[model samples]
Target: MFVDSRRREGAAAFRHIFHVQMDGATSDRESPLMKYNYVALILGVLLILLVVLGNILVCVSVLTERSLQTATNYFIISMSAADLLLALLVLPLFAYSEFLGGKWTLGMTLCDALMTMDVMLCTASIFNLCAISVDRCIAVLVPLKYNQNQFSSRQLGLIAATWVLSLGVASPVIFGMNQVADRDLSTCKLEDDRFVVYSSVCSFFVPCPIMLLLYFWMFWGLRRRRSRTPLKDPCHRRSFCSTLVLALCHAKSLTDSVSDGEARTQRREGQRNRPKTVMRSRKASRVSRRERKAMKVLPVVVGAFLACWTPFFVVHVTKVFCGWCTVSPTLISVVTWLGYVNSAVNPVIYTAFNTAFRNVFHKILSRWM
Candidate 1:
């Protein structure tokens, strides 16, 4: 849905797009904009396919793979469901409208429904990420109570709350708030300025910081615990083994009536081999910083979400208050599609580091291949 020049209500044609021409207003097939639309249409179709495939893999992997059946992965499955629904329920019409130059050919009913689902699902995605962060924080700060990856009532409650709160945020659209007297019939977008602002705050502003802080606390706790109790030294164990081997060699020499000279040679060999054992022990005990990097899916996921969505809410809220400011239609469509890209991007980036999901994904995909 898009907003018109009058700044009145718009519906599901990505509603915040302001100053778009009416339907069939631009029919120049050979024009640059038409060529651009063609490219966008192709890309949009690929994006939909990717989102569907990737999210389906996530859901199936979590359901079918025993290793992925954990509290954290359940949250991921919920998040993937949101992205998958966005692709199935929302993006086709969104891309069609973009091709139509922001004209909402779909009836007002579908437009309203699409707009509601769009807000709810996008917000639900953010909420699920926040929930995952919260779950990780709990596992870090209170390990014994977390039950080592059990899906408890608390996790269920969090997932339920995520959807319910998202619905609450978007319920106003369902209540005919977009049916204003001066609404544009040609374009569909969000109708109420207050709703745009409210949804923006609820979806992005509130949850993003919570995710960031929770991840920060989790890392801090992990580092602090590791610092309090350093890892055991390996040199002591290696030295004991060396002495036992040397004593055994000497005892065998005595049993064979071997001379002290030959026993001293074996003892000297043990002393010479001690440095290699110490080096091997040290290498085995060394910790890599990549271990910390491997656990950084939190930052990557949250950062991608924010990178994709921040522009959208920022533009929407800015358009609400700064009516005099001139934002290009191209910019609006770019940001809107950027949000759509997030649905595809999240499933890929979020599960990229998860070995269980990757293994299951390979197993499922291998059957088709």
Candidate 2:
């Protein structure tokens, strides 16, 4: 029975491959399509360039910025490293294939290696993202107990684990007995439909859902904790610990006081008498409380991951799970490059959202500029 089942599975895979080859040949022979190829080539090149420069900024900012170079930031560095590898290893093939109207000139070994890297890096990025989210949930929920020194070692262990797991799922492409098959257009790819489906599920589908769940849970936990514990800072006289919220609230009260247009004098007096202690204390304690607040920076890192990776994950799910899927060669090329765009986006997200990262990034740019 097992042998029969295997035989049936093999036959189905062969059919899938046969269809793919036929589709490639039909697409190739039907038209010149040079204009479409040119557009695709331009877009792919842009994505590659963006990914390279953006990731570099992120790495430089994290390393050079003393404030951001924490244990949690170490995980960020690992994530960035994975993104860099993705761009380096995967984007060129995607660009070339799309530019030549889905033609593949690279040999069989390269095809296998490229696919492996594509799957491995993307999986690793998502895995690291989930890890970052979990780390933040712990840090935010238990700020007092979350020490960087203690967490750093564990974060490194998690980063290592992500790579191992990613490589494990991607192993079949590199080492499985199934050999790369040539398409009608001479492009080589994994010919085993079962393995392809399995890898896609393992790499994209399974990991993404889990990451989404974790992110939702983390946000809910954060909201709950935030509501339960009123912001308390002995040094600040404001009702809220959030400085921006307090500022906005203070501004609104002033606006209300002035709405009469007759209380202009009173409004000026009120502003004069408004306590300066909160502002002074906020500034004064900022430097002193750096260490105290640094442990809570995990949220910033996780936020970066969420922003950079979410679109790619969403688009991928649409491609893999949708019914009657028939992606154009150009569209596939675009989405593949878009995935690489996530790699470049991670560093940009970090630098843009994190204050410490921004400062560090500015400093690095200044040195070069």
Candidate 3:
């Protein structure tokens, strides 16, 4: 009995010591892990803040400002809504995962919903841009028909279609397609490889080419039209000059008659100003030159979009199709967030390129100040 008691006491002390060492090790491990992810946590929070604030500015500017209430701005508003929804619904969860060092502690159902909203909203953003490109193309080519200032039924239909199509693309995940048997619930991503291909093709591959082609056609038509008619930004000023000349001509007939030399000089001056007269007449008929200015800014927007998202889709597809090729989770996370960075970028692009948006942003921001 005495020997047995001694043995039991020794074993209990050893077990206690072992557990204490383990506790110490775990604390040490957790501290470094926490420190390692602190950068991600800080950056993610800033990104979320930027996206939320910037997109909100866009929404408010378009909604409140009458000048911004054009058809193209309506498309911009729709796109802003998508980005805003993405920042609100999707960025937080994904960012929290990054804070946890990319561990998805949020279970399957929430994760699937995240995936759904993420895919749908991002796709909608791209589609709206595509719609913008198409609208601009039509406006440039067939300027008379496209009401640059008003949203027609066709414009509303196009915006609605983008959202609906995005929903269609993302609906599969919501329908339990992400709930595959024997899959790890801790990992939150699309389950089916085929679905990856489908989403990539629909979201990036399909729209990108179409958008590029439309952009080409738009610029082509614009260049040809510009070459033929030569629309100038100083057209309004030209119209005023033309009006001034007409007024002088009308007023001159009542004045004392000029010498033959002076008469010839006046005739030459009127001939030089004749083109200005034509410009004055065409003032009401010229294409919306604001659309041309918009086209100049669009290449920057499209280039940024492509730069951010191209790597993501390329890596996304390669990981699926080339199973032998190894991609790190870190690389995947980097590219994914890089794509999310686009939501924050667009408002900056608009503010930089557009005077109307810039003025409104300044006005709105001044009130807050």
Candidate 4:
């Protein structure tokens, strides 16, 4: 009986040691894991703040500046508004999901709602950019037809159509067409191939090609106009040539006689003093310095959008088509956040390229100072 009691006590001590060891191991595992979570949380917070603040500044700058109230800028304002909605409604939820290790705790209904808003806002932003390219093309190619009275209605119609089309693409999920099943509760994704194709075409494929084509057309038109117009500095060269020709005439007349020299000098002086009429081409005058800067800056905006969003869409479409293919969660998260970075970039592009926007932004900042 004594031996059995001793054995029981030894067993209790072993179990106690095992528990202590496990506790230490668990803590060792959690320390780095907790650090990672903290880092991710901080990054998410900063990203949200950046997107929200940048887009808000853009919207405010547009609203406060009367010079920026053109039809094209109205589309820009709409794009900023859409991005602002994305930052507010979609990004916070995404950040929370990231914090929770990709587990969406926001339930099924809110999940659907969030996903719908995500697709709608992103698609609308793309359409607005495409519209901006088209509007700029019109303004460059046909300034007379791009007057405010004519273009305002067209721009308004385009903006309305953009939102309507975005809604149409995103509404299928809301109506239970493409939904997350209970078994796949861990994932919040659009599993329907049809929905994926439709949304991809509407959001990326169609608009991207249109934007590219319009920009190419704009560049071509600008290039052609530039080539046709003579360089502006030719006036100086022409003046030098005229002076040389007059000197040659005076030298020739000097050899002839004093009478001939005096006559030629008088004629040349009269020709030089006569009013010089300079005629500038309509196309050269039409594209102002500001418009040229915009033309140069817009391609950078489109390129940035393509760079940030293309990987995400490519992987997304691949996942939709190839069910057997495995994409790491980390890759997905990185690509998605890259796409979100585009929202933060838009306002930076505007402020950098646009003088009026920069001035307004500076004024707005000065108020705080």
- Which candidate has the top score in TM-score? 3
Per-residue alpha-carbon lDDT of candidate 3 for residues 1-369, written as tens digits (9 for 90 to 100):
999999999999999999999999999988856645777778888998999999899999999999888888899889989988998899888888877777788788899999999999999989999999988887877776675345898889999999999999999999988878878776788888888999999999999999999999998887776667645544444566565566567545634677666766666666567656665445434664766878878888899999999999999999998979999999999999899999999999998988888999999999989
TM-score each candidate.
Answer: 0.74, 0.66, 0.82, 0.78
Candidate 3 global lDDT: 0.85
Query: lDDT winner among the candidates?
Result: 3
**Residue pairs clashing, model 2:** none
Off by over 4 Å in 1: 1-36, 233-294
Residue-level lDDT of model 4, residues 137-239, one tens digit each, is 8877875556535447788988898889888889998888666444377657675778888888889988898899999998887777667667764432355
Q: How high is the CA lDDT of each candidate model?
A: 0.78, 0.66, 0.85, 0.79
In candidate 4, stretches whose alpha carbon ends up further than 4 angstroms from where it belongs are 1-36, 148-151, 180-182, 230-284, 287-290
Question: RMSD per prediction, one decimal?
Answer: 13.6, 16.4, 6.1, 8.0
